[model samples]
Target: MTRPSDHDHAPAPAALSADGGRADPAAPPGAPPGHPRRWAGLAVLSASLLLIVMDITILNVALPALSADLRPDSVQLLWIVDVYSLVVSGLLVTVAALGDRFGRRLMLVAGFAVFGVASAAVLLADGPGDVIAVRALLGVGGAMIMPSTLSMIRHLFTDPRERATALGVWAATAAVGSAIGPIVGGALLEHFSWQSAFLVNVPVMVVAIAAGLWLLPESRAARPGRWDAVGTVLSIAGMVALVYAIKHFGKEGFDDPGALVAALVAAVALPAFVVWCLRIPHPILEIRLFRRRAFSAGAVAALCTSLAVAAVLLLLAQWMQLVEGYGPLEAGVRLLPAAVGAVIASPAAPALAARIGARAVLSGGLVVSAAGYLVIAFGPRPLSYATVAVALLLVGAGMGSLAIASAVIMVGAPPEKSGSAAAVDETSYELGAALGVAVLGSVAAAAYRGDLPASWLAERGVTGATAAEARESIGNAMEIAAHAGTAGAELAARAQAAFTTSLEGASLAGGVLLLVAGVLVWVLAPRDLDVSGSSHH
Candidate 1:
């Protein structure tokens, strides 16, 4: 982390209202000054964000290839899949604060360097252990990049409308990246090798780093303080414990003793950190930001929407590949309707919000999302790809609206807190995505297990096997059962049926959650319908 420059000194709380909300417009404190290369700077920032967000889903299509190549145990496979997000979520707040205290531009360049190096490491990784280590490094690099981009944008675009337009572009990148990752990964997996996925980031980051160095201006917290080392440790520990407990519950059930202990640790650590913050002259995480109604509502909405969307995307990919037997390329192509719709909706969100109001946009989006889930839950049995496509289109549209609502949260806040605000929003987004995958993945797995046959062992002609053996060889059991004649065929069909039934139930639950979210958004978001030019990319 870069050291705080001499610019920081004693200042009053940044013009926040008693409720911790910004009562004044988010204008720059001085006359609007132009940067020689602001547009190039914004582009570099956008590229950085696109690379990090896109990576979130890039590995989805590579899971089978990865498993075959790495030959990891189940536990290793889980970590290989989740450790990037786990580490990223744990470190976001601490890293974001570090950037604010030091310099956003310096952090951006350093982060890009780290990401490029880490990507190279992952591509060259010889085994699962190496890949996991590289992924953790990528997470650290991502932690630095995310907040810097938002803070730079906060500093770059001083006008509210201009800022909203910039943020709209930023939000569009996220939707586009999410939409494109699997397709890109699939193409790479088919024509080249899995290593190509990591290699691709090299060029993107290189361009971004060069442009950032030439164009981005230095910006930092107006009244920086000493790096809060103790606060950083407490925050990471609390987040890791909390997320680990949640992840453990999804995997081993809520009753697992280890998960219970993790949950307890999280409970104690999080509050203790907050109390510690109150005592510190300069805290790493400004927990007081939550007092802002718009900020608070926006953060919660971002988390909820992300959680719902991540779960849906994961399950949908499984439905297409495992259940429907679609090839990687074919499945990725089928996802285009949703991706295209989201991209189209994303750019139009600012104008739409201007017409209907932010609260209405959010509430309406949630309603559309809930309806999409209902369509999935009640769609014809044996599944129709067309039905799935249409449902995703609706879900994508809804997500576009929520993205705009979130843009408002930052646009309306004081500029000094922009990094912190963006940090909070981004944190919710990543954490929500992680929880979504974990909770939904676990539910889906349990459903798959429940749907499996008691006759599986008998069909294989095995009375018993060691726990590790059974877990590792579940796929072999299915293959064996399929070849064992009429009994095996019946067992296989029953298992498939059970899994599909579980998917239907999960979709229905998702619909209910989206509906509840819609109601909350309607009740909680601000009534003002106008767009301010205060937010940035």
Candidate 2:
């Protein structure tokens, strides 16, 4: 009759302390059974790694164009852009644990196959419904890809230093993937159709699938736990509700009925799920992991970084093309400095951490990021592309360093829980991005309203109900008002001004968050980088 919590259990070393420190447990006292195929395996794994990361943000540059072509209503467009992340966030923990239960390489190869077919589905989609369905399926594939890669790395490299170096490379590829999404999408959209963006994934996925089959080594859970169906449902439902709630708050504030309902549902469900986790004999995600200080710190940092930078690519794409009138490709080309900076800085992070301490490097990077945000926030009324690019490079540098924080979490976690740990990290990253778009974008919308002239609505031929509706969709409204003669011209100017002010406010808020995160990291992250067996390779 006794509950699970009543069961006597010996805690892990980290679990016994207040700070909940980690212990190295990946490699046994004896050396790992060395695989002669390690080199080819690592290469194949890394290459396959790039595609999953790339898919996460590659569609951003094409969103505006896609919106026009599809003529989706406001909600539909947001889903078209956000469903991928939302689904990915909700399923990461479940999928990661599944990979651990099944086999990492097997899951990875299966993931590639699923991702390829999903990408093809996206390419062939003729309507919004089709695209959305395909995108959701892509998320399923992505959930499989993410944890498998990290867990495979854990099994592949036994030496902590080599593992750290390999993770740095892995982290760099992730950063590069985010950067490449826009550039590749921009180029493909400019020269070909929007479908080409999805199409490009096909070839990359094919390569990964083939390479994985040939070169990747197989590994799975050393001691697997039973899948917790109840926990899985609660986690996914709670996440979906929470994201919807957050999005609702951004769009309609605290008072909106939809927001209220969603928030309440999430509040109840998430806590209930946590209780369920503590009670379950085998939870899908080990809730006890958060008790680790390093894991907790890393999770917070990851979320903060993504929240602060989520709007960067999207807003920048708008700043470059919509406000400045640069073509998609031209805008992406101009943004290359930041991409270059991120790529260069990403690889150098572990080395930097070794010298200055992970705490110092991460904290310093956050502070630098705050500075970048301020530069963008207070820049000239009609922003200069060059100035924005410079600020973006600083932002990129900040992000580059932030990427290493994952290594901290992974290395700090017990190797037995590597897949779950990585899954948690990836989930935080995805959640941050989704929340950033929803919250920051809302802030921008509010600022736009305040900046607009009273006459602006009348000028655009949007009066009464139409004007109220138009206010809800500044982008679409502005586009419609742009070609309406003198009145349209005035409306366009007002819309532009509104959007600019909104952006400025969002940037300022982001700046403050970045600074706070810096302080937190400096104060909370452990001084020593003694992550060994605790982290997966």
Candidate 1 residue 71 C-alpha distance from true site, Å: 4.8
- Per-residue CA lDDT of model 1 for 205-247, tens digit only, reads 8888888888899988787667788877887887778766766
Which candidate leads in lDDT? 2
lDDT by residue for model 2 (92-178), tens:
777777777888888888889988999898756777778888888988887777767767766776644344445555665666666
Runs of candidate 1 exceeding 4 Å displacement: 1-30, 71-78, 123-129, 158-162, 278-281, 411-416, 453-457, 462-499, 529-537
Q: How far is candidate 2 from the true structure (C-alpha RMSD, Å)?
A: 6.9
Candidate 1 accuracy as lDDT: 0.66
TM-scores for all candidates: the values are 0.84, 0.87
* Each model's lDDT: 0.66, 0.68
For candidate 1, list the clashing residue pairs, or say none: 159-533, 160-532, 160-533, 160-534, 161-533, 163-535
